[model samples]
Target: MHLLGRKSKKMAPLFLALVVSLMTFALAVPAIQLNAQKLGEGSTTIQSPAGKGAVNFVLDNNNPDNLIGVTVSFNETLPAGSIIYVKLYNGGTLVTSASKQLTADLSAGSGIEIDFTSAVPISDFDRVAVVVKGPTIQP
Candidate 1:
């Protein structure tokens, strides 16, 4: 019984060391940050003449990030050949616009990202707008 007690004492240190190593590994793991950008244009849900979806706008911080893109999440599938228009506006005037036509049917609740063909500076616009020219549906 004493021999068994000594063996358990020895095993306690190994167990403690294993626990410490696992804790250290857990602490060393880096955090996951999604779309870690410098600035964001906020998000909103909009009902379009063609369809409905939630839009998230992201602004370029020029942290080598000169590209602007729009993320849209619909409650239903968006059919192929549907066109999504993303526009930048300065006051009442339109600064620039980018668009993409859906190549395949986008699944419901799945978000789609449409990026500008070329770099468009965020400094040129204060307002962002999205217009969908496709099917009429509710979000």
Candidate 2:
């Protein structure tokens, strides 16, 4: 009878431990699935029209190295003889600037690509803002 009591105590603790472990796992699986769902898979694209305005691009550690490329797609036709100016700023300081003249009316879905390479390392930047200015379009 003493041996039976000892065995019951040992088994009781083991069963309690197993129950706790299963409860923990059961509670954790839903959280893991929710996090996975939040990290939705895909790329995001933005389209804008031609106008004199500014667009800000936020850069983080995840940005590509050596080259930062931005493609602006126009939603409508721009005015004639207009020009687009692209400027890159890091932490309130101007880093690089470029411009392209509008030869033909910017077609819907057609846009410009602005590339920045000469700026300081992304590690040195806390934030990056791209300002696009033109006749009618503002990014």
Candidate 3:
């Protein structure tokens, strides 16, 4: 009778451990499925231009008819009389271009915002590229 009682006590812990492991596996299964669904989306990468400046901007879908618009911001400390040129391109074609000249003394982290819209339908293009050229920054 004493040997039988010891064997029964050992079996109790073994049963409890098995039940706990199964519960943990059940809870983790749904979280794994949710993360797998998010992996299908795509992302965009922006390349900084030449010179010693930084361009930080956001692309927003403004018009319902045209699905693309870009807002550009630049930070640079340029001399009082410096000229900067900005260009936008869709594939190999030039879409829009702009230039600016600084009047007063500018700071190193100073920036400006510009918006560009497409004349033709945005859906016609597969990829879009924006290029900047000037004395201060490039992105």
Best by lDDT: 1
Instruction: Give the Cα lDDT of each candidate.
Output: 0.75, 0.57, 0.54
True lDDT of residue 17, candidate 2: 96
Per-candidate TM equals 0.51, 0.40, 0.37
lDDT of 2 by residue, 24-129 (tens): 9998885434434454457666444443333434233464443354565555566555566666566787766656666667666665666555534545445444
Deviation in Å, model 3, residue 115 alpha carbon: 4.7
On residues 17-84, what C-alpha lDDT tens digit does candidate 3 reach at each position? 99999998988786544434553347766344333555444344464545333333345455555555
Cα lDDT over the full model 3: 0.54
Reference-based TM-score, model 1:
0.51
Best TM-score among the predictions, by candidate number: 1
Error of 2 at 86 (Å): 1.3
Winner of 1 and 2 under lDDT = 1
Worst 10 residues of 2 by lDDT: 51-60
Q: How far does residue 3 in candidate 3 sit from its true spot (Å)?
A: 99
What residue pairs clash in candidate 2, if any at all? 50-136, 50-137, 51-136, 51-137, 52-136, 52-137, 53-138, 54-139, 55-139
How big is the positional error of residue 111 in model 1, measured in Å on the Cα after superposition? 1.6
How far off is residue 49 in model 1, in Å? 7.6
